[model samples]
Target chain A: MSVLLDPFAYSFMVRGFWVATLIGVTCGLLSCFVILKGWSLLGDALSHAVVPGVVVSHLMAWPLVVGAFISGMLAAVGIGGLRKLSGLKGDTSIGIMFTAFFAVGMLLISAFPSMLSLTTILFGNLLGIAPHDALQLLVISLFCIGVIALRWKDLLLFTFDEQQTIGQGLSVRGLQLLMLALIALVAVAALQAVGAILVMAMLITPGATAFLLTRRFPAMLLYAALLGGGLAFGGVYLSYFLDVSAGGVVVLLQFIVFFPILLCSPRGMGWLCSARGGVR
Target chain B: MRTPSLRGLALTANNGSIAVDIQHLSVGYSNGVIALDDVSAQLPSGAICAVLGANGGGKSTLCKALMGIQRPHRGSVRLFGGAVNRMLKRNTIAYVPQSDDIDWDFPVSVQDVVMMGRQGQMNWLRIPSRDDKRRVAQSLERVGMQAVARRQIGELSGGQKKRVFIARALAQHARLMLLDEPFTGVDMTTENDLLDILREERNAGTTIMVVTHNLSSVPDYSDQVMMLNRRVIACGPTAHTFTATHLGNTFGGVVNELLKVTGAVAGEGNVAMSRSQLPEYPQ
Candidate 1:
């Protein structure tokens, strides 16, 4: 027990846990919408899109997050533009834009070797998060949560049927843009804890895991946040003892939690399992 | 004629209201195909207009144009005797799109889906009040879906999904309702229930425009018929417009052949006879 609890004695470990919990909670809540809207790929796209922004920001001496958010939103816009102009489906557009931005980020790194470390950008530096960076993560998480709370019904309805939302005199376009912006902000905030690639797992897996556990959306949201925070806490503790990367461990732990629930999902194998009284 | 009930009287306090007035409405897609070409029609309050056409005959295009979801290339659509945007801002229209358009996998309960209709009435940032909850519950009860109110939308059958969407329209309390193919794939019981609900809405003076290929029940369910083949081929009372000639013009002789195949004479009483006999139309 002392060995397990030893990591919390350090200040950096405490801060890392805090940031991880915040990212987990916010990303988990937002991921329900992400899964519902068939935008699982969008999370992947926006996270990769931030790489170019981080590169540009490093070159210009600007805040890395500010640069990440701008580029993330730009990627979303680029996907939308390609959808409109090239008549491509949303998934195809996402695939095109993310790869292009990721390539640009790679090129920038190879050219300006001293500007920023590729591994640090691709894989987050959780323990090295400064107090200001932690504060920034907290603010972004709050903004995303607040907007979701205040406009729950509007967001829910818009995701279900956009045309009906417009018919009822709601701003469907505005809500869509707002959702995209929130995704971008959350992606930027998650940059320091999980990096761009693995943040996709944090964004989608927790919500998906909770979805199998509950029928009600609000309950699902709560379950996802708790599950996410718990997993983050557990992964941090294990990473310290195992001497492994916290970001990778957190994501790996999420999958470790997800696959079993998926197999025993109510609509999946749980039906047979329940009849046989095999697994609860 | 059915007597207007007291609730109907309160709903139609503004009687003789013109709900939709369109003139020279032309709409085209980016692919340069003109979906609607110079179509014009006016429907009054308490009227049910059944928009009929073959596939790709601008039936959905006209509905979208009327809802202001699509821009008109040429003319105008006036709802509630005002601009489409102005009327929309006033929450005057409720739309039930086809089931194919909805994301059935969305994580919302049947009751929650119905509650979305109240968004037009409630101001932004204000949570649902007691009245909103009451209205949503009443709407669910009206659709006979109160039993499954807690079930996820994906759990419902095809017919039940149609009822849920209709329940949403009922909850909106809008003056005009536009339904795109509400009867498609619905069971007989669900269809009859939907027609009864539509009649109650009409008796309450709500303007209804239902886009459907189901011509058999057109005369039985709707007060007027607007036949379309990329433009207004015929628009008038169902008694005068459900003729062999008009249907031929709209469906391009396939309907005439279909009537022959089904062995139903396309004339007076054609609407009722077609309802019972014609299966080739296959709405």
Candidate 2:
């Protein structure tokens, strides 16, 4: 029992656990929209695109979250613009924009070697998070979750049927930009919890798992949030005992939960037997 | 710009009778291809207008223009004497798009989809009211799809999917309804049932514009016909305008072959043939 409670005794561990869970819940909520809109590559692009912004912030002493958000949003807008202007496919646009931003980050880091640590940016230092950083993550997570809750129906309609949304006098462009902005904001908030490298997994896995588990969107959302929060708590708690990386373990735990659900959920491979048996 | 006198004449010409009024509308793609060119039409309220054309004959583009999805490079669209966007915001317009435009794999229930029609009437947060729920149920029942209201949209068959979309339009209580290819994949029975529903709506004073390449059913159902080939080849009452010359001009070479295959005479006043005798237009 003491061994189980040991991690909670440490202040940093408690802070880390709360921050990870908040990020997990927020990402999980946003992930439903991301998955339904087929924007997994956009999530990945936004996450990596924040790297140069972090480096620039460290050099100029700006707020890291602000720089990261602006950077991610810029990448998103650039991808949109490139797709529109060049008639390039969506994946190609995303690939070109994110790689360019990430490479610039790599170049900046090498040129100013002592400024920022690559390892810390790629794999987050959750245990070493400052109080100010935790507060930033909290505020961002709450804001994102609030926006999603308030406009969920409109967002869902826009994703499901863009033409109807437009015909109903809703701003399809506004909803699209709102989705990209939310993704950027979530990517920024998650940057502190899971870092740039694994943020995409945190955004996609929970929603995808929920998708396999349920047919209704609202149920999918509820399941995703619960699964995300539970996985984060479990990862943080187990990582303290295992002495493994908390962020790494959190992402791994998502996959660990994902595969079993994929194999057993009604929408997945399990449907084969259930469908066949019912037919018989 | 038109002079004020001409504008007044245009306004009084349509008065409150027109459901859709487009004047010299032209829409072009970014790649310099014109989708609609100098298209003009004024359809009256409480009528079924069949927009007939070949593939790429600007049928979908006209629908989008009416729905304010595609911006016209020139001219204007007015619905019921108001701007298109303004009428849309009043919840007076509903659109049933082609099934191919929707993500069938989306995790939305049929009832939830129908409820989307009430979004404009809901509060800012879009929570459905009791009245909204009642309307959704009524709309689903109208389409004979109330039994599957709880089912996911992806679980529905093609005909059921089309009915669900039609139910969504009905739930909107829209004064003007636009449907793109509402009968592409439907069976003959379902198609007839859908046409009956449209007739009912028309009787209820709803203006319906149906965009379809299927030509056989137009003369029977449509009160007005707008034959388009990037421009309006003919636009008037169905009895006067749905002639073989207009169809041949709208579909280009395809109508000649279709006339031969169907063994229907291409002369004036003999173009109205039964669906069984006419082959489906080559798309």
- Which of the numbered candidates is closest to the native, going by highest DockQ? 2
TM-score of 1: 0.93
How well does chain B match by TM-score in each candidate? 0.90, 0.91
Clashing pairs in 2: none
Question: What would the per-residue lDDT of candidate 2 be over residues A29-134, giving only the tens digit for each residue?
Answer: 9999999999999999999998888889889998787888888889988999999898888999999999999999889989999997888888888888999889
Tell me each candidate's i-RMS in Å. 2.8, 2.3
Find the 10 residues in a row with the least total lDDT in model 1 chain B.
Answer: B3-12
Q: Candidate 1: give the TM-score of chain A.
A: 0.94
Predicted candidate 2 versus true structure: per-residue lDDT over B11-70, tens digit per residue: 333534888889999999877889999999988888888899988999988988888878
Candidate 1's DockQ is 0.48
* Alpha-carbon runs more than 4 Å astray in model 2: A272-280, B1-16, B267-277
Q: Model 2 — interface RMS deviation? A: 2.3
Fraction of native contacts (fnat) of each candidate: 0.57, 0.67
RMSD of 2: 5.2
lDDT of 1 at A214: 76
Best by lDDT: 2
Model 1 Cα shift for residue A50 (angstroms): 1.5
